[model samples]
Target: MFKTTVTPRFGDIDGLKHANNIAIAIWFEQARNPVFRLFTPDLDLSYENWKLIMARTEYDYVGEMFYGHDVEIISYISRIGNSSFVVTQEAWQNGTKGAIGRSTIVHYDFLNKKSEPIPDDIRKKLEEHLQNEDNSCK
Candidate 1:
Protein backbone atom coordinates (compact mmCIF):
# COMPACT_ATOMS: atom_id res chain seq x y z
CA MET A 1 0.00 0.00 0.00
CA PHE A 2 1.20 3.52 -0.82
CA LYS A 3 1.13 5.57 2.34
CA THR A 4 0.60 9.34 2.38
CA THR A 5 1.83 11.61 5.16
CA VAL A 6 2.86 15.15 5.85
CA THR A 7 6.63 15.71 5.87
CA PRO A 8 7.43 18.04 8.73
CA ARG A 9 11.06 19.07 9.07
CA PHE A 10 12.66 22.49 9.27
CA GLY A 11 16.09 21.32 8.13
CA ASP A 12 14.71 19.75 4.96
CA ILE A 13 14.23 23.21 3.52
CA ASP A 14 17.11 25.01 1.86
CA GLY A 15 18.10 28.63 1.25
CA LEU A 16 15.65 28.69 -1.66
CA LYS A 17 12.92 28.36 0.97
CA HIS A 18 11.75 25.05 -0.43
CA ALA A 19 12.45 21.39 0.06
CA ASN A 20 15.96 20.71 -1.11
CA ASN A 21 16.62 18.23 -3.91
CA ILE A 22 18.50 15.98 -1.49
CA ALA A 23 15.46 16.01 0.79
CA ILE A 24 13.30 14.88 -2.09
CA ALA A 25 15.67 11.99 -2.72
CA ILE A 26 15.51 11.00 0.92
CA TRP A 27 11.71 11.13 0.87
CA PHE A 28 11.56 8.93 -2.19
CA GLU A 29 13.96 6.44 -0.59
CA GLN A 30 11.75 6.25 2.48
CA ALA A 31 8.64 5.77 0.38
CA ARG A 32 10.07 2.96 -1.75
CA ASN A 33 11.19 0.70 1.08
CA PRO A 34 7.95 -1.22 0.79
CA VAL A 35 8.75 -2.39 -2.68
CA PHE A 36 12.03 -3.85 -1.54
CA ARG A 37 10.39 -5.47 1.47
CA LEU A 38 7.77 -7.03 -0.75
CA PHE A 39 10.40 -8.66 -2.89
CA THR A 40 12.94 -9.69 -0.28
CA PRO A 41 13.79 -8.87 3.31
CA ASP A 42 17.51 -8.92 2.79
CA LEU A 43 17.69 -6.87 -0.36
CA ASP A 44 21.45 -7.11 -0.03
CA LEU A 45 21.15 -10.86 -0.11
CA SER A 46 20.21 -10.75 -3.78
CA TYR A 47 23.47 -9.08 -4.68
CA GLU A 48 25.34 -11.88 -3.03
CA ASN A 49 22.96 -14.49 -4.38
CA TRP A 50 22.66 -13.00 -7.87
CA LYS A 51 24.86 -9.86 -8.11
CA LEU A 52 22.69 -6.71 -8.24
CA ILE A 53 23.35 -3.14 -7.17
CA MET A 54 21.74 0.25 -7.45
CA ALA A 55 23.25 1.56 -10.65
CA ARG A 56 21.89 5.06 -11.19
CA THR A 57 19.33 7.56 -10.02
CA GLU A 58 17.79 10.77 -11.33
CA TYR A 59 15.21 13.27 -10.13
CA ASP A 60 13.22 15.96 -11.89
CA TYR A 61 11.51 18.72 -9.97
CA VAL A 62 8.17 19.81 -11.37
CA GLY A 63 6.83 22.23 -8.76
CA GLU A 64 8.04 23.97 -5.65
CA MET A 65 7.59 21.96 -2.44
CA PHE A 66 7.83 23.33 1.04
CA TYR A 67 8.05 21.87 4.52
CA GLY A 68 4.87 21.41 6.61
CA HIS A 69 2.93 20.57 3.46
CA ASP A 70 1.42 17.16 3.12
CA VAL A 71 3.63 15.19 0.74
CA GLU A 72 2.50 12.03 -0.89
CA ILE A 73 5.25 9.90 -2.37
CA ILE A 74 4.04 7.26 -4.80
CA SER A 75 6.36 4.34 -5.43
CA TYR A 76 6.15 1.90 -8.28
CA ILE A 77 8.36 -0.34 -10.33
CA SER A 78 8.85 0.99 -13.83
CA ARG A 79 10.97 -1.41 -15.86
CA ILE A 80 12.64 -4.74 -15.23
CA GLY A 81 15.63 -5.86 -17.18
CA ASN A 82 17.51 -9.12 -17.32
CA SER A 83 20.08 -7.72 -14.90
CA SER A 84 18.54 -4.51 -13.59
CA PHE A 85 15.26 -2.83 -12.73
CA VAL A 86 14.11 0.78 -12.78
CA VAL A 87 11.95 2.19 -10.01
CA THR A 88 9.86 5.29 -10.61
CA GLN A 89 8.77 7.55 -7.79
CA GLU A 90 6.68 10.68 -7.67
CA ALA A 91 6.07 13.24 -4.94
CA TRP A 92 2.79 15.09 -4.78
CA GLN A 93 1.32 17.99 -2.85
CA ASN A 94 -2.43 18.58 -2.82
CA GLY A 95 -2.84 16.16 -5.74
CA THR A 96 -0.30 18.05 -7.86
CA LYS A 97 2.81 16.30 -9.11
CA GLY A 98 5.68 18.12 -7.42
CA ALA A 99 8.67 15.95 -8.26
CA ILE A 100 9.54 12.72 -10.01
CA GLY A 101 12.54 10.39 -9.61
CA ARG A 102 13.85 7.11 -10.92
CA SER A 103 16.48 4.68 -9.77
CA THR A 104 18.19 1.89 -11.71
CA ILE A 105 19.42 -1.01 -9.66
CA VAL A 106 21.72 -3.77 -10.89
CA HIS A 107 22.70 -7.10 -9.43
CA TYR A 108 26.14 -7.41 -7.88
CA ASP A 109 28.28 -9.93 -6.07
CA PHE A 110 29.52 -9.14 -2.59
CA LEU A 111 32.53 -11.40 -2.88
CA ASN A 112 33.60 -9.53 -5.96
CA LYS A 113 32.01 -6.33 -4.74
CA LYS A 114 31.09 -5.47 -8.30
CA SER A 115 27.97 -5.12 -10.39
CA GLU A 116 26.36 -8.29 -11.74
CA PRO A 117 23.03 -9.52 -13.09
CA ILE A 118 19.71 -9.50 -11.25
CA PRO A 119 18.29 -12.72 -9.87
CA ASP A 120 15.38 -14.64 -11.34
CA ASP A 121 12.93 -14.38 -8.41
CA ILE A 122 13.43 -10.66 -7.96
CA ARG A 123 13.21 -10.09 -11.70
CA LYS A 124 9.94 -11.93 -11.83
CA LYS A 125 8.51 -9.81 -9.05
CA LEU A 126 9.69 -6.64 -10.72
CA GLU A 127 8.15 -7.71 -14.01
CA GLU A 128 4.87 -8.52 -12.36
CA HIS A 129 4.52 -5.34 -10.30
CA LEU A 130 6.16 -2.84 -12.61
CA GLN A 131 3.12 -2.89 -14.90
CA ASN A 132 1.24 0.39 -15.37
CA GLU A 133 -1.91 1.48 -17.19
CA ASP A 134 -0.04 2.14 -20.40
CA ASN A 135 1.55 -1.29 -20.29
CA SER A 136 -1.81 -2.87 -21.03
CA CYS A 137 -2.02 -0.92 -24.27
CA LYS A 138 1.30 -2.30 -25.41
Candidate 2:
Protein backbone atom coordinates (compact mmCIF):
# COMPACT_ATOMS: atom_id res chain seq x y z
CA MET A 1 0.00 0.00 0.00
CA PHE A 2 1.07 3.59 -0.59
CA LYS A 3 -0.17 7.00 0.51
CA THR A 4 0.72 10.45 -0.79
CA THR A 5 -0.28 13.93 0.25
CA VAL A 6 -0.71 16.74 -2.26
CA THR A 7 -1.45 20.34 -1.65
CA PRO A 8 -4.21 21.59 -3.91
CA ARG A 9 -3.18 24.56 -5.97
CA PHE A 10 -5.56 27.40 -6.81
CA GLY A 11 -5.95 26.01 -10.30
CA ASP A 12 -7.00 22.61 -8.96
CA ILE A 13 -10.32 24.00 -7.76
CA ASP A 14 -13.32 24.81 -9.89
CA GLY A 15 -15.54 27.86 -9.76
CA LEU A 16 -17.52 26.14 -7.02
CA LYS A 17 -14.37 25.91 -4.90
CA HIS A 18 -14.14 22.15 -5.14
CA ALA A 19 -11.30 20.13 -6.57
CA ASN A 20 -11.97 19.57 -10.24
CA ASN A 21 -12.70 16.11 -11.55
CA ILE A 22 -9.50 16.06 -13.56
CA ALA A 23 -7.53 16.90 -10.45
CA ILE A 24 -8.46 13.61 -8.84
CA ALA A 25 -6.97 11.64 -11.70
CA ILE A 26 -3.74 13.59 -11.55
CA TRP A 27 -3.50 13.11 -7.80
CA PHE A 28 -4.05 9.37 -8.07
CA GLU A 29 -1.33 9.16 -10.70
CA GLN A 30 1.05 10.87 -8.31
CA ALA A 31 0.16 8.38 -5.60
CA ARG A 32 1.31 5.52 -7.85
CA ASN A 33 4.90 6.83 -8.00
CA PRO A 34 6.11 4.32 -5.43
CA VAL A 35 4.93 1.37 -7.49
CA PHE A 36 6.30 2.93 -10.61
CA ARG A 37 9.67 3.51 -9.01
CA LEU A 38 9.79 -0.09 -7.87
CA PHE A 39 9.41 -1.27 -11.43
CA THR A 40 11.80 1.25 -12.92
CA PRO A 41 14.61 1.81 -10.50
CA ASP A 42 16.44 4.35 -12.62
CA LEU A 43 13.40 6.14 -14.01
CA ASP A 44 14.49 5.38 -17.51
CA LEU A 45 12.23 6.19 -20.42
CA SER A 46 13.71 3.51 -22.66
CA TYR A 47 11.15 1.23 -24.26
CA GLU A 48 12.63 -1.75 -22.44
CA ASN A 49 12.26 -0.11 -19.04
CA TRP A 50 8.94 1.59 -19.61
CA LYS A 51 6.74 -1.44 -19.17
CA LEU A 52 3.49 -0.03 -17.85
CA ILE A 53 0.74 1.27 -20.05
CA MET A 54 -2.52 2.65 -18.80
CA ALA A 55 -5.38 0.54 -20.11
CA ARG A 56 -8.28 2.18 -18.32
CA THR A 57 -9.08 4.64 -15.56
CA GLU A 58 -12.27 5.78 -13.85
CA TYR A 59 -13.36 7.74 -10.81
CA ASP A 60 -16.28 8.45 -8.49
CA TYR A 61 -16.68 11.66 -6.59
CA VAL A 62 -18.19 10.97 -3.19
CA GLY A 63 -17.45 14.32 -1.58
CA GLU A 64 -16.08 17.76 -2.41
CA MET A 65 -12.55 19.02 -1.79
CA PHE A 66 -11.34 22.57 -1.44
CA TYR A 67 -8.05 24.40 -1.27
CA GLY A 68 -5.94 25.49 1.72
CA HIS A 69 -4.96 22.00 2.88
CA ASP A 70 -3.54 18.72 1.68
CA VAL A 71 -5.43 15.79 0.20
CA GLU A 72 -4.20 12.30 1.02
CA ILE A 73 -4.46 9.58 -1.59
CA ILE A 74 -4.23 5.91 -0.67
CA SER A 75 -3.25 3.40 -3.34
CA TYR A 76 -3.70 -0.37 -3.34
CA ILE A 77 -3.27 -3.13 -5.85
CA SER A 78 -6.63 -4.82 -6.38
CA ARG A 79 -5.85 -7.46 -8.95
CA ILE A 80 -2.91 -9.07 -10.71
CA GLY A 81 -3.13 -10.78 -14.04
CA ASN A 82 -0.57 -12.21 -16.44
CA SER A 83 0.04 -8.81 -18.02
CA SER A 84 -2.09 -6.35 -16.15
CA PHE A 85 -2.93 -5.09 -12.67
CA VAL A 86 -5.72 -3.00 -11.21
CA VAL A 87 -4.96 -0.07 -8.97
CA THR A 88 -7.53 1.32 -6.54
CA GLN A 89 -7.12 4.76 -5.08
CA GLU A 90 -8.98 6.77 -2.46
CA ALA A 91 -8.84 10.54 -2.09
CA TRP A 92 -9.42 11.82 1.40
CA GLN A 93 -9.75 15.37 2.59
CA ASN A 94 -10.90 16.91 5.83
CA GLY A 95 -11.15 13.43 7.32
CA THR A 96 -13.64 12.21 4.73
CA LYS A 97 -13.55 10.30 1.47
CA GLY A 98 -13.61 12.78 -1.39
CA ALA A 99 -13.16 10.49 -4.34
CA ILE A 100 -12.22 6.97 -5.38
CA GLY A 101 -10.56 5.78 -8.57
CA ARG A 102 -9.55 2.57 -10.32
CA SER A 103 -7.03 2.14 -13.07
CA THR A 104 -5.84 -0.79 -15.14
CA ILE A 105 -2.15 -0.89 -15.96
CA VAL A 106 -0.69 -3.39 -18.36
CA HIS A 107 2.87 -4.57 -18.55
CA TYR A 108 3.73 -4.01 -22.17
CA ASP A 109 6.50 -3.83 -24.68
CA PHE A 110 6.03 -0.69 -26.69
CA LEU A 111 8.46 -1.75 -29.35
CA ASN A 112 6.50 -4.89 -30.23
CA LYS A 113 3.14 -3.47 -29.25
CA LYS A 114 2.06 -6.43 -27.13
CA SER A 115 1.42 -7.10 -23.45
CA GLU A 116 4.07 -8.86 -21.42
CA PRO A 117 3.79 -10.85 -18.25
CA ILE A 118 4.79 -9.05 -15.08
CA PRO A 119 8.16 -10.09 -13.74
CA ASP A 120 8.27 -12.19 -10.57
CA ASP A 121 10.03 -9.54 -8.52
CA ILE A 122 7.58 -6.83 -9.54
CA ARG A 123 4.61 -9.11 -9.00
CA LYS A 124 5.79 -10.03 -5.53
CA LYS A 125 6.14 -6.37 -4.61
CA LEU A 126 2.69 -5.59 -5.95
CA GLU A 127 1.21 -8.51 -4.04
CA GLU A 128 2.43 -6.98 -0.82
CA HIS A 129 -0.06 -4.17 -1.37
CA LEU A 130 -3.04 -6.19 -2.63
CA GLN A 131 -6.48 -5.37 -1.22
CA ASN A 132 -9.63 -5.85 -3.21
CA GLU A 133 -12.89 -4.02 -2.56
CA ASP A 134 -14.25 -6.99 -0.67
CA ASN A 135 -11.51 -6.99 1.95
CA SER A 136 -10.20 -3.46 1.89
CA CYS A 137 -9.66 -1.58 5.15
CA LYS A 138 -11.89 1.43 5.37
Candidate 3:
Protein backbone atom coordinates (compact mmCIF):
# COMPACT_ATOMS: atom_id res chain seq x y z
CA MET A 1 0.00 0.00 0.00
CA PHE A 2 1.02 3.62 -0.54
CA LYS A 3 0.81 6.04 2.39
CA THR A 4 0.80 9.83 2.54
CA THR A 5 -0.02 12.54 5.01
CA VAL A 6 -2.16 15.63 4.53
CA THR A 7 -2.14 18.50 6.97
CA PRO A 8 -5.65 19.78 7.27
CA ARG A 9 -5.84 23.50 6.62
CA PHE A 10 -7.84 25.88 8.78
CA GLY A 11 -10.05 26.63 5.81
CA ASP A 12 -10.89 22.97 5.58
CA ILE A 13 -12.84 23.12 8.82
CA ASP A 14 -16.58 23.30 8.51
CA GLY A 15 -19.13 25.01 10.71
CA LEU A 16 -18.96 21.94 12.92
CA LYS A 17 -15.23 22.59 13.43
CA HIS A 18 -14.22 19.38 11.75
CA ALA A 19 -12.77 18.90 8.29
CA ASN A 20 -15.48 19.11 5.69
CA ASN A 21 -16.48 16.07 3.71
CA ILE A 22 -15.38 17.78 0.52
CA ALA A 23 -11.92 18.26 1.91
CA ILE A 24 -11.57 14.54 2.46
CA ALA A 25 -12.47 13.91 -1.16
CA ILE A 26 -9.86 16.34 -2.37
CA TRP A 27 -7.26 14.82 -0.10
CA PHE A 28 -8.02 11.36 -1.41
CA GLU A 29 -7.60 12.55 -4.97
CA GLN A 30 -4.28 14.16 -4.17
CA ALA A 31 -3.06 10.98 -2.54
CA ARG A 32 -3.69 9.17 -5.80
CA ASN A 33 -0.75 10.93 -7.47
CA PRO A 34 1.48 7.91 -7.08
CA VAL A 35 -0.98 5.60 -8.76
CA PHE A 36 -1.44 8.12 -11.51
CA ARG A 37 2.28 8.05 -12.09
CA LEU A 38 2.20 4.35 -12.92
CA PHE A 39 0.24 5.16 -16.05
CA THR A 40 1.68 8.55 -16.87
CA PRO A 41 5.27 8.63 -15.72
CA ASP A 42 5.75 12.34 -16.36
CA LEU A 43 2.39 13.27 -14.84
CA ASP A 44 1.33 15.06 -17.98
CA LEU A 45 -2.12 16.60 -18.00
CA SER A 46 -2.55 17.20 -21.71
CA TYR A 47 -5.53 15.34 -23.08
CA GLU A 48 -3.40 13.82 -25.81
CA ASN A 49 -1.09 12.22 -23.25
CA TRP A 50 -3.53 11.55 -20.45
CA LYS A 51 -4.86 8.01 -20.69
CA LEU A 52 -6.95 7.58 -17.57
CA ILE A 53 -10.42 8.82 -16.74
CA MET A 54 -12.45 8.64 -13.58
CA ALA A 55 -15.56 6.55 -13.97
CA ARG A 56 -16.95 6.74 -10.46
CA THR A 57 -16.14 7.55 -6.89
CA GLU A 58 -17.78 6.99 -3.53
CA TYR A 59 -16.90 7.80 0.03
CA ASP A 60 -18.20 6.83 3.43
CA TYR A 61 -17.55 8.99 6.47
CA VAL A 62 -17.01 6.93 9.59
CA GLY A 63 -15.53 9.51 11.96
CA GLU A 64 -14.88 13.23 12.21
CA MET A 65 -11.56 14.65 11.04
CA PHE A 66 -10.52 17.76 12.86
CA TYR A 67 -8.33 20.57 11.58
CA GLY A 68 -4.80 21.10 12.93
CA HIS A 69 -4.24 17.36 12.75
CA ASP A 70 -2.51 15.41 10.05
CA VAL A 71 -4.64 12.97 8.08
CA GLU A 72 -3.04 9.76 6.94
CA ILE A 73 -4.17 8.48 3.60
CA ILE A 74 -3.68 4.85 2.66
CA SER A 75 -4.12 3.92 -0.95
CA TYR A 76 -3.90 0.63 -2.82
CA ILE A 77 -5.30 -1.26 -5.70
CA SER A 78 -8.36 -3.18 -4.64
CA ARG A 79 -9.48 -4.54 -7.99
CA ILE A 80 -7.98 -4.73 -11.47
CA GLY A 81 -9.83 -5.44 -14.64
CA ASN A 82 -9.19 -5.38 -18.38
CA SER A 83 -10.05 -1.75 -18.95
CA SER A 84 -10.44 -0.34 -15.49
CA PHE A 85 -9.37 -0.69 -11.89
CA VAL A 86 -10.61 0.33 -8.46
CA VAL A 87 -8.47 2.37 -6.10
CA THR A 88 -9.35 1.90 -2.45
CA GLN A 89 -8.29 4.50 0.06
CA GLU A 90 -8.77 5.33 3.70
CA ALA A 91 -8.48 8.53 5.69
CA TRP A 92 -7.29 8.26 9.25
CA GLN A 93 -7.00 10.96 11.90
CA ASN A 94 -6.03 10.70 15.53
CA GLY A 95 -5.63 6.94 15.18
CA THR A 96 -9.20 6.48 13.95
CA LYS A 97 -10.45 5.83 10.46
CA GLY A 98 -12.29 8.91 9.27
CA ALA A 99 -13.43 7.80 5.83
CA ILE A 100 -13.17 5.08 3.20
CA GLY A 101 -13.29 5.67 -0.51
CA ARG A 102 -13.14 3.86 -3.83
CA SER A 103 -12.47 5.37 -7.21
CA THR A 104 -12.91 3.59 -10.51
CA ILE A 105 -10.42 4.69 -13.15
CA VAL A 106 -10.53 3.58 -16.74
CA HIS A 107 -7.78 3.49 -19.32
CA TYR A 108 -8.89 5.07 -22.54
CA ASP A 109 -7.74 6.26 -25.91
CA PHE A 110 -8.71 9.88 -26.16
CA LEU A 111 -8.39 9.94 -29.89
CA ASN A 112 -10.58 6.89 -30.27
CA LYS A 113 -12.88 7.98 -27.50
CA LYS A 114 -13.14 4.47 -26.14
CA SER A 115 -11.89 2.54 -23.16
CA GLU A 116 -8.77 0.45 -23.71
CA PRO A 117 -7.24 -2.46 -21.87
CA ILE A 118 -4.51 -1.55 -19.47
CA PRO A 119 -1.07 -2.41 -20.67
CA ASP A 120 0.37 -5.62 -19.22
CA ASP A 121 3.37 -3.80 -17.73
CA ILE A 122 1.15 -1.22 -16.05
CA ARG A 123 -1.14 -3.94 -14.71
CA LYS A 124 1.82 -5.70 -13.14
CA LYS A 125 2.92 -2.47 -11.50
CA LEU A 126 -0.54 -1.96 -10.04
CA GLU A 127 -0.60 -5.51 -8.70
CA GLU A 128 2.43 -4.75 -6.61
CA HIS A 129 0.36 -2.30 -4.59
CA LEU A 130 -2.68 -4.54 -4.22
CA GLN A 131 -4.10 -4.39 -0.73
CA ASN A 132 -4.10 -7.59 1.25
CA GLU A 133 -7.17 -8.64 3.19
CA ASP A 134 -5.40 -7.97 6.46
CA ASN A 135 -4.22 -4.49 5.54
CA SER A 136 -5.85 -1.74 7.59
CA CYS A 137 -5.18 1.38 9.60
CA LYS A 138 -3.69 0.61 12.94
Query: Each candidate's TM vs. the true structure?
Result: 0.78, 0.94, 0.96
What is candidate 3's lDDT per residue for 1-138, written digit by digit as tens? 889999999888999998898899999999999999999999999989999999999999999999888999999999999999999999998899999999999998998899999999999999999875357756
> How does each model score on lDDT?
0.72, 0.89, 0.93
Tell me which of candidates 1 and 2 scores higher on lDDT. 2
> How many clashing residue pairs are found in candidate 2?
0
| Top TM-score prediction, candidate number | 3
lDDT of 2 by residue, 17-124 (tens): 999999889999889888787678776879777878999999999998999989999899999999899999999887888998999999889989999999999999
Candidate 2 residues lying further than 4 Å off, grouped into runs, are 135-138
| Clash count of each predicted structure | 7, 0, 0
Candidate 1 lDDT tens digits, 1-138: 255464748988998789888889899888867666644566555434534457899999989898778788877777877666777877887777788888887655668776656667766666666746243210
User: How are the candidates ranked when ordered by lDDT, highest leading?
Assistant: 3, 2, 1
Q: What is the C-alpha RMSD of each candidate to the true structure, in Å?
A: 4.0, 1.2, 1.1
